[model samples]
Target: MRRLALVAALALSANAYPAQAQAVAETADPYIWLEDIYSPRAMAWVEAENARSLAVLKADPQFAGFYADALKIAEATDRIAMPRQIGGQIANLWQDGTHVHGLWRITSPAEYEKAEPAWQTLLDLDALSAAEKANWVWAGADCEPTAERRCLVALSDGGEDANIQREFDLATRSFVSGGFTLPKSKQWVSWETPDSLIAARDWGAGTMTASGYPFVVKRVKRGAPLEAASEVFRGKPDDVFVIPRTFTDGAGHSEVVIMRGITFFEAEFVRVTPQGTTPIAVPRKSTVTGLTQGRLIFQVNEDWTPAGGQPISAGSLVAVDPAGKAAPEVIFAPGPRQSVDADEVAVTQGHVLAAVYDNVRGRAMRFTRTASGWQQSVLPLPDNAAISMVSSDRASNTAYVSVQSYLLPTALWKVDAAAGTAIQIKQTPARFAADGLVTEQFMATSKDGTKVPYFITHRADMPLTGTTPTLMTAYGGFQISYTPAYSGVTGKLWLERGGAYVVANIRGGGEFGPAWHEAGLKTKRQVIYDDFAAVAEDLMARKITSPQKLGIYGGSNGGLLMGVELIQRPELFGAVSIQIPLLDMLRYEKLSAGASWVGEYGTMANPDEKAFWLKTSPYSNLKPGAPYPETLIWTTTKDDRVGPVQARKFAARMKEYGLPYLYYESTAGGHGAGANLKEKAMTIALEMVYFQRRLMDTK
Candidate 1:
């Protein structure tokens, strides 16, 4: 019945849009019923749609092979056990053939460094899920500070962002009876101590914000009911979210902080003490990276002028003794084309390791406190690669850094902060034959004359032709940097099968820090779309790939990019893969978590922003008879981030207007589209198959 309903809706929607691109009317929409997520009727429609999509895609000749190889790659036992330091022991969450849902296990550092570590499982998600008949997904644990053993374990059902946190003992390796337990809701929690906690979650009624996140924080003591917990801090319902975060420095100094996320990139940090909440006098664009030596260390993303001191640069790392009366001191500052990597800071005992990028190349520095003041020295590391901090702790000067490039498999390095020395710990075994793969950087001139950098990975001997089947992707939003990293699945499934890949580092990202992102924010967002289209056009101009063989893919914000480009520049692409996207820009604010992103994407309530969205919104501008590539639109029913409704509405609208599009939605996996390894592998296979059919295989 649901399938027939969709078919009927498609027939009506085939001509849903106006002849000219114009502001869409709410009255024209015919598939708002699909927005009822998880209702039996809506789910029935989803199941029928999934069945139809599976029947078609699974019958493709490449489907079986892609699935087999992806499953093998996912289930491979030899993959590195990325170690997480906990309680002076190495912990890891692993999933393979033996353990499908994954096993949170622990081992010693010495044992972990060995080829095959004897791992002791602390929690088996698969077994627990089976026993309870619930789809239990591990969200991670926040442990006690002193012992770092007793923890508050977070578990989500069906992979929702909202989850239930329960306390567990690491010594006994079991959930303690009558332990600290918070009922399921989107929350922020931290251990005030073993006997008490600081948290913000849905208490009863009107506790969550308009965006479905907690706005009030409370102190819940052991053995006390949630309602009896005293309110510590409260935020307005319109704010993004309020979080209670506990930061512990190397010298046994700890600070309880309340982070009020006013916008996506803007936040306010306040110190919570016995007296009350005191606001920290830092720029709203600054982040408290880590604490060290009783000094609050953070990276400033906006030009900040203290009460009386001169201004600090936008991309400078600064340290301040918040408890003292000393002025803020800039620790490190990057020059013209340099920016600190967003996720590259790690705090070790008495030291902070930072990775900075210049012209898309990586460099590291170690900052240590001295008698006079804090000082920094360069740490030896390879350039022209993406480097990340895998694991680090405040207990010791031991940290792990993983480095990789487009062609290079990731290699882990253990860095000693005291000596500023690093040693190779492990290198991933190459999953595919890469005798002569070339990685080259190129720049495309955007419409606004901004130079956008991109990476191309292809066979070294391949000719400069306009017919290579190239898959291009980009994500240009939210100050997130897109760096070079090795992907086993991409190599084994796509590259080995004679496909070239390109990654475009456009504006609205932290590629060159705050300034680069600022240029593409809100009202100036068209430059980001223009940057992506310019890269695609540049690829064709360089004879790398032409429209006949070019495919593009992106998820989340990237998916929105795909949508905009699909409508605005349809002739440039042969295939489009949009996963978990936002399409209905006019009504986006009312969608799940849409109101929270108003800073990144301007609210439609404003006249100028509404006009801008009306002119360029993919959903609003999708008119009938427009030339568009055969597109694949996939999402998950459990996705609470962008939600699955957007995808459903877009597909239904496309069908209404008789456009070429494919739609599929998984029942679980939340925002990512899968819960277990097999589920993820299948989605990958399906996506690759779609690309192969459009760009590689002769139809």
Candidate 2:
């Protein structure tokens, strides 16, 4: 067993913090050695912990059945091949039992509309991995703007975010000899031209940010080595990642824009030209989605009033020309109850398609810059479902969208933005039985009297006996909205087994736009946790389920929520699954990519923020004899984004306190767990088994 405390004090530099606070925080933490991710002691401990936990969980009578079912669903060839319009073809990365790594394939738009599209394999990752004797994962491919023949293909080793970019030719179906090949590193790259590349990675010493990301952008010619690359732009080392993106419109108009991330939610954008880089006027909390008709289309998250200009409210889509010839136009300003889905916004040849959540439900709108002004019209699609833009083509007014509800499988819709017409093209075959299941939305008032909405899916005839085994989850951070989507695994594994599931749209999320998220930032985050706990209590109040029958799970930021809930509201849940969590708030900034999130979670260097963590940090709050539920804590060794150190230290501290817990860390799989389909299936199956044992098994 590991010791509870170490001998040496944790030294925080005087420059980084106040002397007194640094001295106070220097007190020994037992598992600091776990921070050395590949150290011998850490690996040994992980091995033993995995063996111990797997022995019990895999011994469950239903584990094999659960694993088989999950695997079947994961590797099913009938699964929908999600398509993206690229280079005049519909491209998709498909994985099955045979193609574990995946097969990057492409088909024509006409053939893709059919039930069984004729796909030609562009890259066989499995064969490539086998030949190279390396575990390669397909990241993505970026094609040149005009010709769309030469492309930069990114491949990750194992599943880490850091990858190598190799220039490949679509015409020859092979990698270009002596072409642009960037070594493996956490980087961002875009084509400056057919002969030159603009990139940001680990250029050399003093080039990386504190967040383990590249802050320097450089331009490399076709035959130049990385060392010979010339500096194009330089951001501060304290800043987050810097990216140079090129946007092209239908009229052969192309613009290269460089973004220097001041923080996670803030940035400075500049248009790069042969003359010089010029500042693109936009709010700090705004993103330039694309360039359409020489106009930069962007969405602002904060209300802005320009100098001698009209005030634009928060959550508004607007466009501005780089030439400053035309005044800024408000494409779409969301209503009070409407919030734009940032990930769903796309620019096509003749229109800008954006998906917005209206009162937590989805609606798609098309914005076109007409002679009069910007005209907005709602796209004709299924309502009461989560609608999202899948892909859009800049060469044509063709796009694809997806719609899915809690009970409805996902369906693909092809839209003609020019004609304002949409048709359902393809849909996923139902993986599980949903005939008897129903979904309903409910609202629960938080401790501060703020109403939070949540959705529950269960049998229509469920009795109000408060005995149903229920599992609830929520991600209440990062300005991300948790919308309704069909989950075949949850429906087939849990719902089919007489269990109910809940999704709480609590505070600290973008459900109602920036205001809703900013309402729970920093010390005000207690309300987000309160909203989740309130939803659990509301379920009990409605006789849906009791405390002993309730389980909750989340990953990444959501994992942090689970940790807080396990400490703050232990009696409300039977099991808590914290996956790839950030537990040690005091030291989170020192971990991988953690410093980038200071915009969302405040830094400990601030006196008030330090005080808040002292009270709310889960690792610091765990006691010897708390009535805590046995937690399923899991993370990946290759999770370079959040890093596994936080999870490891938290679990080690739990052990020191003699608390009930289970820890499993996979050797691969990066931020999102499981390197391959089988691994992912096993992880899901393990969760199902653990939930069944903790929440459903009545003695």
Candidate 3:
């Protein structure tokens, strides 16, 4: 029996584990061996490897044909320049490449009229199918400026089935379309757009549908019976709704009236009459955007600057009555030097609750209005843990809060605000057995002796001999913290399969605060890399893992981290996963959408900035004869946010080096891995399978 057990264990270890592990048996900090494999002096060798990789990819005859076919559709479309805020002079040159085959995001009336030529040109495109041209009829061409203004363009095909929808001005161009059972259903029904001032509902054949906006009461026909009908706010309205200056006093408080539809003939009226509604002082610079509900809320700024200017100012809420007599009352007041934004207030059942973040102590307070006055309470959150309140369910009387810290994975709790008690609702599932999972907090010494905090999770059952498989993940840019949220991908394959996981809260992240983020940006980017390496070494010193078992993974800016690490210390990790990495630092500023990242990553235009960027850019440091890790690069062709060409070029270079690697690009998905639920699940499954197959084998 003992012999059989020993044979079984050896068989599992030899065949199921990664084959490359047998080559390197020595236990050492991977960073220490960087000089041995990397030749900083013979830098030309690295550049040659990169050149050879590019040559092979460009030499492929089929590559050009494939790209030409792809570009053909894009070129046939009528392209227009759309403005974006972040990346300077960014445009969405839409052409025949769009599946929906129509004009999108018509900014103004002029643009709408001008689009007719493009629409006709689109119709003239011979490549498009007849059905594709028909799809254009459903598209809503233009968006007006104000919520009160409604612009209707007749469909080219005079049919109710023409799928028209309202689009918002947000970056994504999100549109709300009326739901129907069939693609060409002819049941004509009016729906409220996002910008609609009022919403009304009608009952027909036991079903209720929105009648229209700026709703009015209608009498029911005889012999047809239904439940009581009324017009109510459709969605969660904004807290502050602004009225025009024509309705407001010189101080900005308007003698407004709000009418609620009670019956077809009679309506419940509440008016702030000039006699009853007293003129309240309001800032002249105040602007009001209507909330989803009927209540009117506005922001008042003492300074002429926009109301959204810096915080630390007083604001009031003015609730207009339909009867033109009662004046608006101030429901909320700014507390001392603390400023409250529009999102801080939650209105429910004729009462308002506010969740105010104390910028001083880094804590949050909950304030509610009572009959006596305003009541205040301190929310219960761990002193060290950072808390972010996401949402509250008034119907359930429950609020969801996420809590995380350096030593802990994120945990979600359901807090009963009325009771002031928090209940842990969900926790990250333990991938490995309890005895096998271990977490440790360590402070790594940077070049300046700055103590950087990092955490490592590994198999406790494994011997502390620095030989266990390890994967380190970090995102040290954009002031975004690498918090321990529950990840279905990482939990199942990496940790559960006898591997280790480490999350490095290095500099350039907002883990500690804003100061921590500013510490490792631009000229200080090297600090983040240094901090990441130090954490890897700490794991080695503790005899928790070795360099042969180490693998690093990151995406986006973090992709840049993994790239630079591979160039700087090729021996540090056995495998690297670079997903949509931002490589080619010098030319990145020239890519289709790379210019936007210049704010976060300093622009190369400035000589000093270029010098600093060159020092850390992974593309600039690839050397020959270096034992590079087995890399897997992934990207999406439909990624308008981060162009797929970045990954394509990097993968091309790695292949030139004759390096072991895999390149997988999704033809149809945006910067987000997938568009729908099923696609998202499949992507996660693929990632898990890839990591497990690569990391679990030990020859």
Candidate 4:
């Protein structure tokens, strides 16, 4: 959950700044040279704002049918290959239009329950990025869960989260020549055995972390020389990242934990041993998550007790043991509209699975301990969809989940985690036309009287009489739940062209737990922007879309919630988009990985979080000729996590306040706005032709 995302500047004044925004409320940030990212005057203002917003969003006429229906639903080779177990095979990766940097492959679990499996590739990545000229991408692979054929892999560059790990070798498929590489930076590594590797990277200059991660952990062995690794565990330097993680249980315990993180929703965890590092009593808003019979599960998020037992609660799950002699227990406890999906928990050898959710609708529980104690069950699966685990196998209880919703169509079940049963196996093929489209889930309320939830979808016999074109979105921030899946590019570029989308579930998300994301943390983020402007004033008071047929969108922490609903409700959105954002909450902690989110945004050396970033920062409340709306601000110039300098100093202070927005960045997706499927089908056909020129044209 440490995926915090971004924001930055302004101390607000000078009639909220316009004479060239009084050099950003007097002196300094006047578009801080667009944060020098690739200078030459910031790549000539990002190639003149990406050729003037991709020439009016690729000259509209439905931008070549929304970039050929989002590059045919991103090169759809019958879409859902998804599975990842990796022991008796299954792994995956694929990608189409003839492998545009993909195809990791591997199949077997009885040829992945057959409907045409045979797989096997084991690493093509567009022929190793054309034999290493390198645009690489595919950052995954750890392998060695007890000899699953030695791995490590990672890669990344164009999709940048600093990668390059290497090692490989699944029964000699390739790369191990003088093995265990490592090179790049934002790393973590694992295995801890079959020739060692505890890791957590960038061990050079004072070993990183004022959020560029790697708070030093090290061990390294197999052909050594990462400057002769050894360290073990360090952490401080403004903490936020120290990872490690090795945990095995296949009837042979094995350990190595580490974690550390210290903010962006806390952490500490520890363990290691060959006689050292212990800590682990759990609760620094807990996590650990996985390992079975030798115990260690965790989850928590805040409400534990320990030192002589009994209290648990905060989104509970528990378990414990790390040889501290039993007594932790719970292993489930959610129910106040449940929550548990710490990125779809998993473990499996004799079950743990988890996925939960409840009100945000998703299922799978499993659990299992035995001898008169922990037991659980649930996993039959399908029901108001969402589900997801998708890969488990700690030497087999077998796993893979998936399901779907918002007009269904996803499927892929295959569970059998010691027979709590599941079975479907692959489905997908219905890209759009959900008959009359329905999906409900409402609730709204919010300007303090809480509630929120959202959903939408549309056209069940239309006309609530408010000009429908809609859109809407939310992330609220980090606890990251924002559920209801099925998208095939928002059902083929905007609900098969009639529109209406939504999503909300606001209050700093995780749907409804950790007290709904600590009820919007750090300076209580205006109740997560009044729960996304009360789900856009409850969709314009249920006429279902107004304020000129609404429109909103988010990205990176919901693009700082679409730059705070475009400056605190600019007449409640006509269109905003703002992807990969963070629009300056006072120099979002000197940008990039924004100082690992001062514990979910609070420290401008905390004077009431600098008066809530001078009254809630969207680039210091973007003022100038004010009634906002036309936004589409985009990001990604290889975003090393929220970098493209706060979307290039908020699109160069909205082009020095002459205002009307539209800017783009892209040169390869990093903080995701696209890196591959034809740069994510030209950033979803330039955000569905800028939400069809702001909520279906005809102004």
Which regions of candidate 1 fall more than 4 Å away from where they truly are?
1-19, 26-28
> Per-residue alpha-carbon lDDT of model 4 for 49-143, expressed as tens digits?
88998899898898888888888888988777898876677788878788888889887788777778888787898988998798998989988
TM-scores for the candidates: 0.96, 0.96, 0.52, 0.32
Judge candidate 1 at residue 462 and give its lDDT.
Answer: 70
lDDT leaderboard ranking: 2, 1, 4, 3
| lDDT digits (tens) for residues 66-159 of candidate 1 | 9999999889888888878888999999999888878999999888888889999899999999998999988988888877989999999888
lDDT (10s digit) by residue, model 3, range 552-630:
8888788888887776555456678887678767667655445545555777778777766555565544443346656
lDDT of 2 by residue, 1-699 (tens): 111122012212112223333443557877899999999999999999999899989999999999999999889888789887788988899999999999988899999888788999888999999999989988889998888888899999889999999998887878999999999999999998999988999988999999999999999998988899988899999998899999999988998899999999899998889987888888999888888988989889999986567999988988977666667788988888788877889999979998888879997889999899899888999887898888999999999999999899999999999998899998888878888889999999888898889999999999999989999999999899999998888988999988999999998999899999999898788888889999999999999998778899999999999998887777778889999999989999999999999988899999888777766777777756667778999999999999999999999988988999999999988897798999899989888889999988763
Q: What is the C-alpha lDDT of each candidate?
A: 0.85, 0.88, 0.47, 0.81
For candidate 1, list the clashing residue pairs, or say none. 13-656, 13-657, 14-656, 14-657, 14-658
**lDDT score, candidate 3, position 600:** 59
**Better model by lDDT: candidate 1 vs candidate 4:** 1
lDDT of 2: 0.88
**Candidate 2: Cα lDDT at 635:** 95
User: RMSD (Cα, Å) of candidate 2?
Assistant: 5.0
Candidate 4 achieves a global lDDT of: 0.81
